[model samples]
Target: MEKIRLGKTGMMVTRLGFGGIPIQRLTEAEAVKVVQRCLDLGVNYIDTANGYTTSEERIGKAVKGRRHDVYIATKTFPGDAEMVEKNLELSLKRLDTDYIDLYQFHSVNDMDTLNRILDPENGLYRIFEKAKKAGKIRHIGITSHQMDAAKAEVKTGKFETIMFPFNFITSEPAKELLPLCREHDMGFIVMKPLAGGMLDNATLCFKYLLQFPDVVSIPGIEKIQEIDEIAAIYEGPHNITSAERKEMKRMTDELGTRFCRRCEYCQPCAQGIPISLIMTFPSFVKRLPPDWYLKGGFIPEAMEKAAECTECGECEEKCPFNLPIREMIKESYSLYEQVKAANTK
Candidate 1:
């Protein structure tokens, strides 16, 4: 219902945009319905990615006749110029569009990766510049979970926007990165506004983020009900009431210790365990039905993968949040086993 300027791209996007990740799990027809519902509710910014299996295609199909009604943004993993070029073509094809409104280099976590993408000889930035000049994309943006990478990109003044995790629990971005974006006139897009679904109250989540006027949050939307819930917030009060703030404080305090934001920096576990997935199981157990967790790929085979962790501490070194990932994995595995046993009974 309300619009904000998307940095120097000069595109006015809705504060509550459509995040395309969850739509990948839905059937094409189902995904289309959800996306159309978003547009029907006047949500005009659609953020998807080349990495998200069929997200781009589904958004493309849903917005076929209504392309002009939305600003389409999508991303690809960082790579050399040639690889980026290839991915760009694939995204264009999948979206069935001539040009994307915003194109981002996805998940750049550190300065080294940022340098690689910005390198002139073989870097992806050059290709993105060319694409912009050729009208293949309207603007270039970058997304990352790491604050260091985000700060570095903002200093370079290369990207028109920066997408980062921003919620009550993860407030690091608000301190410096957000101020930098404001100073640079760069659009600040808030990803993971609900903290990877750890924060269940969508109304409070939206209220918390709306405090920062410049930031646009794209929470993952897969169901019309989610759209309805978010839309209700748009029509309601804009400011966070004192009571609401108190409730937020309580929720954050409760979740402060054990919650995993799923930044995925603690990746490539030595035992070949998916640390993010394993750590996320506990939250799923709390919020979702056991059958939903199992059918959603939290099967025994996957849960048992956590048992392979050697507790070597390598993942902890890389974890920015300093979570006790080792113990968390153990606890998550135990919960998974208990849930599985109970479900079988």
Candidate 2:
């Protein structure tokens, strides 16, 4: 039931917003039930993207009668003007709504892509502008994984909101993006607060974010218990206790600063390496179902491919966060060794 002003958008959304990704894993009826649970608990903001499989369609079915009760925000990948409009039309049809509360350009990672998308003549902004005029979308916003791109979007003063990854381990955005959002009065939509499911303690994550009441966070939901837990946080102690802080420190210390966010800006490696996936294989193995590992043999196959890095420095240069690609791949190799040893036992 707790709400905050969504910056210049002027829409007061619940601090605990609904993320649309996890619902894709559920059956259609189950997904709709999960969404209804959030809305029924007085949490009123939802975000979905075109790439999240059936997220948009499930959300559409969930809000069948009470569309006005919740504010729906969905995103589309960048495309030409016509293609962008097609995405919007399809989203509207999927959501079963004529207008969306917010429509964003999803994943504009670097300035080049940002500039191209914002280009007045050749980019998708004109299409968004036209759609805004036609009442297809009420406001325009953007989401990014890189700090540079996120900061640039805010500086342009064109977007109404900015979504970025911000958890205890990945607090780089707080250095500048947070201040810029305040200065520009742009809404801050938080994603990956749990570090893409790497952080197991959801209560700790939600409590940690309570210090920033001005921002809204959308942790992907696929269950009624998740919303109940968030509601309990709102009703319970509003600050991190000493025990909670110690637990948080332990989690962040274990995760460390070298986590790969899977941004994929460093793509198409000349050595035929999936650098992002290779770097994150350890985390994926931990978070997925137990049997997904399935003897963990092919993990070495992928890690060996990453081990072929020529140390050419090309991938590190393109990485927005300047991650040490070779070093992390080596770390992944070490982790794979441990997994391999365990499986052999």
Candidate 3:
């Protein structure tokens, strides 16, 4: 319901925008219906990516003929100039749009990658400049999970906005990244507003984030109920009551910083390990009934995958949070075994 300028880009968008990840799980018709419902409720910004499988395609289909009603921001995985151009064309076709409002360099997580992409002579940025002039994209932005990469990008002044993981538990961005965004007049778009669905207190989380006027959060949505719930949050008070504060503290204390946010950056695991889902298994068990896993479905299947892990460390290398993913997977598998043993009686 409330709007803010996305920093120097100067594009006005609502505080609660649409995150384009979770909807990839929905069918085209279901995704279209839910996304249209979200727009009808006054949420005007949608962030999608070429890497998110069917996300861009679904959003594109959902917003057909109503492009003027929302801001569509999508990211491309960094690549050579030609590859970058090809990615752009594919995005435009999939999004069914000739021009994009904000195009970001997705997951530029290290200095080497950042430097390579920013190179004027041979880097992919040249193509973005070309696209901007051609009216294919209006603004350039960057998304990163690494603090160093994000800060370097800000100093380059090449990006108009920065999307990063920010939430009550993972609040480190506030100390440096948030201020840098303010200093540079860059838009700070929060990618994991609900800490990748690990935090169940959506009401408190959204209310807490609303306290900062400069920060905009795009929590992934797939259901129409979530759309209506977020709209209600906008209408509700932003202040945290004492009970809510206590609950927030309990959650923060319980989670600390080691848990996964289910970002899926460590995907394509060499052993086909579903690292994010396995990492989130503990949280899932807690949320469900005690015997949910005892029914013997995906948990056993995932545990089989987890047990096959060679500890190749490939997933850890790609993880932005630097989590001990292999160890966590093992722990989850052990928990699964414990439940199985208990159920044998």
Top of the candidates by lDDT: 1
- Which model, 1 or 2, shows the larger TM-score? 1
What's the count of clashing pairs in each model shown? 0, 0, 0
TM-scores of the candidates are 0.85, 0.84, 0.81
Please give the ranking of all candidate structures by TM-score, highest first, separated by commas. 1, 2, 3
Error of 2 at 232 (Å): 1.2
Task: Show the lowest summed lDDT stretch of 10 residues, model 1.
Answer: 289-298
**Model 2 C-alpha lDDT per residue in residues 183-293, reported as the tens digit of each score:** 999999999888877787888888887878788999888679987987788768888889999998887766665677666778768998878768877765554432344
What tens-digit string does per-residue lDDT give for candidate 3 at 164-192? 98988878788998999999999999987
Alpha carbon lDDT of each predicted model: 0.87, 0.84, 0.84
How far residue 299's Cα lies from its native spot in candidate 3, in Å, is: 17
Q: What value does the lDDT take at residue 220 in candidate 1?
A: 90
- RMSD to truth, every model: 4.1, 5.0, 6.5
* Model 3 residue 148 distance off true place after TM-score fit, in angstroms: 1.8
Rank all candidate structures by their lDDT, best first, as comma-separated numbers: 1, 3, 2
The local distance difference test score of model 3 is 0.84
Q: Write the per-residue lDDT of candidate 1 for residues 137-194, one digit (tens) a residue.
A: 9999999877767888999999999999899988778789999998999999999888
